[model samples]
Target chain A: MKLFKKMRGGLSCDDVMEVLQSYLDGETDTETARKVASHLDECTDCDLESSVYQNIRVSLSTNKAPIDPVVLDSLRQFGERVSRGEID
Target chain B: MTERPTEVDSPAASADATEAFNRYVIPELEVMYRTARSLTRNQTDAEDLVQDTLLRAFRAIERFDGRYPRAWLLTIMRNANINRARKKRPDLLDDPDLTFERSVDFAETTGPEELVVDPTFDASVTDAFAELSTDFRQVVELVDLNGLAYQEAADILGVPVGTVMSRLHRARKRIRDHLAEHGLDSAAALPRGATR
Candidate 1:
């Protein structure tokens, strides 16, 4: 399905799909990221796929559980004691 | 067997070690705690794990070379967690993969009736997240929720970086599918003025 359709940088929609997640996560290498970006720019189908994934990321991120402040404070004090050589 | 020479740190050396611990390890406590929480899935265990990690890091501070402290601390935390698990469940010694299966029980209280209404994109995503398997949800929690990079998540989860990528992408794909089912796949669902 659209495997042979080449977009910018000669990346097919399938090729972009393979690494699109990595590209969105900023985990892809420079060259592959560039190619995937170009392909997304030219291919509406791939672009929509990217948008959907991005929107999902945004939604998931919004629901991040808040770290407990009391827990964080205790950890900080623990670190301080460790730094002061109070704890072995 | 030859006995090794006893070593003792001079005052200056001890001070330097303390300085290094403060400089490198102090700032990463929160991240360490958060990762520990993800790994232990319980508040008390997470606190214990982080304290254990801190003690180990303090002991090793003199030789740390002060580079990539977060990565270094995470590696220590991973080892510490393995030891904790081994001590708790001796059976885990036979299968190493079982050591990293800690699950994060996020949003377990949201009832099914709440999910039935309000098919907004956010609601769909929350539903999908709840439905994800422990492995998929763990990866998402490490990378997306906890904001750890792929390599960092892999280090904490005791998996390869590629494994993290695979789990994270599949998890998000599942969420995207859920959104599509709610008619959120169209361009209208994209953020306003989102060119990418």
Candidate 2:
């Protein structure tokens, strides 16, 4: 089934996997992204691969260390000082 | 010796520089701090690096054409970080605790109770992330954790954009493989059409 789908002029599973990360990252060009999307829609294996990668991204993204608001506030104040020419 | 007159020396020019700094630099402080944290891997050093970058950006604000300010500031931050690294003791440069390994430790200590995904899956991903080389971990931290674009991560790492993409893809592939090994790559783990 996958082979038959590959012969249908869309990106093969190999081609999709080659650029899969870029396609997921939204870094692929529009045409390539469209092709990859089309391939994923038709290929169960590639779609599962994409899902696993996406899940990994979500898991890792959720693991971000909490940013300290105090530090951000301090930086903001420092930037304000710079804008006011208070810091040399 | 008399200092030559410059654009920044005039009152009007100083005001323009200040406005430009406020417009371009001020809004990006959090992002600057996050990138600094990724580079320095220490809170105190990250804050100091950002402060240094802010100062340099202020000094150069008059010359900035108000385009791609984040990229502009990241370049300054990268330079500042390089200078800071140069001044550090050689032994201190090899401090493993100051690496992204610490970020993994932080993840272990913090709970992801709010995430709806499987805890085991999350743990597997974190384990895979912790095992990545420093180069891979740095790119992941900058692009994934800090939400930086490929070019932005490359600028901060002083590498080519292609290098960033290559490292990021390879690193994530490692994590995906780890997940597959743990049997977490099953279709049941992820719904159909699930994507970020």
Candidate 3:
């Protein structure tokens, strides 16, 4: 339960929307995130919108093109060589 | 600003630097490669970029304090990417103070049925990510995808934390709207409010 709501009134939908990313990203202060969470509990629109944003983020993160094995090996070898000053 | 060449003052110090590079920097190649791939969006270019970054990091290895090597490597990669981009097209450079006022605007062009029933959400998301401007994509990759904090991403990109916040917000909105346009059928497979 957000007991802080009694100390600070709940944020309006527009206000919650304004910082929704920060709220989701855990960038918001504790009081502000709790306020946003409280708003989402009562507002289906913001809840669904937040869900969609998260999905997009997951997609971007997981959809990376696989690195070429040869390129990977080459980079590793290069790092080793460079680390040892085997090559300038 | 003029650049000073990094010099290894002694053989013992050089060996220490090499040891540090193996211990601190080698372990972070995968992350560096991923970030490079995201920035360059090309396999060849990404490889070259990582190579260039590693070279620079190696030269400066003696000065590294073994702190947050991944972030330090990423900052180098970001600078290398920008310098490469600047050389190709000077206008692609970012102006940190420019207000991204339209960060919240979106075109909700997709229907709920498409999001809930379709299976091509990943493809659509990939396309949308490609469609993003380089600036927006940088924050998304560093903050959202790479799981770096706002302050860390800002430091890596040489931008203010506020800029990272605003740009990331805008970039995520565009992505959300793009997913919405495709009807987010993928969400049906996920529990409500599930995040990576």
Candidate 4:
């Protein structure tokens, strides 16, 4: 907190957060995203958040458990049964 | 019942749902189970809770209305687990440290850093996250991992978008620092722009 006092309101944890979220969602524009990227390269604290957000992106995207085929088949059948009014 | 040469979005949805359930939801079981394990802190209770989430998800899908099926599924699972916990023990809501001990004896060979390389880093990160006050962790999980837009995650969690944004920043910073203190920090190993 003390370290970032120099950046002024021009760059804040919130601005960095917006950039971080934008980066993860792949929604940031080319120019500002680039600025955020370059700034992060030099800013250790921002770099830490940048790192965590990306890892979070990967973990959520890739590390999920695989739902079983039987479970899926079972759910599909249940969907069918409900569509047919088999269950109240 | 036959594979149509052309895709019907409805039937296709069912198939895609099946596939998503298999490809996405199934893979998350252990992780979700691990989360449930952390939340419940008992193997039997975690298993029961997980099974309940699966069943509830299937039932909920019948009337579900969302385009992002995976996020919708996780939302259901998360809500289900929380409701079950509340029902099981209403009083423990405020007291978080009841279940798991704070300290972990990480493996010597890997140290904490090596383990950060694995996807289980979420578990470590999540444990760090778990250390936070629940209000912060709620917003972090909803917006960050679940990928809801600020307003959407807020709408689902019933909070203001501004609240979600700020709490998330605090929770995120605390998580990063906690990982650092525990030696699981990913800053040194991660892609450069990633940390900034």
Q: Which stretches of candidate 2 lie over 4 Å from their true place?
A: A1-9, B1-13, B90-116, B187-193
Query: What is the per-residue lDDT of model 1 for residues A1-88, given as tens digits with 9 covering 90 to 100?
Result: 4446666677877788899988888888999988898887788788888877776666666666667799899888877677656666
Docking class of 4: incorrect
In model 3, pairs of residues that clash are B110-B181, B115-B183, B115-B184, B115-B185
DockQ of 4: 0.18
- Scored by DockQ, the top model is 2
C-alpha lDDT of candidate 3 relative to the true structure: 0.70
In order, what DockQ does each candidate have? 0.45, 0.48, 0.33, 0.18
Ranking by DockQ: 2, 1, 3, 4
Ranked candidates, highest lDDT first: 2, 1, 3, 4
After superposition, candidate 1 runs with Cα above 4 Å error: B1-13, B100-104, B109-119, B192-196
**Model 1 lDDT at residue B6:** 29
Task: Give lDDT tens digits, candidate 2, residues B55-160.
Answer: 8898898888889999999999988887777577445465523432334343553466634567788888888988888889889888888889999999988889
Question: Residue B49's C-alpha lDDT in candidate 3?
Answer: 88
TM-score of chain A of each: 0.88, 0.89, 0.69, 0.58
Pick the winner on TM-score between candidates 2 and 3.
Answer: 2
What candidate 4 gets wrong by more than 4 Å, as runs, is A1-19, A26-49, A59-69, B1-116, B119-123, B183-196
What is the docking quality class of candidate 1?
Answer: acceptable
- Encode model 3's per-residue lDDT on B71-119: one tens digit a residue: 7888887777777777766665574223221232111322333334223
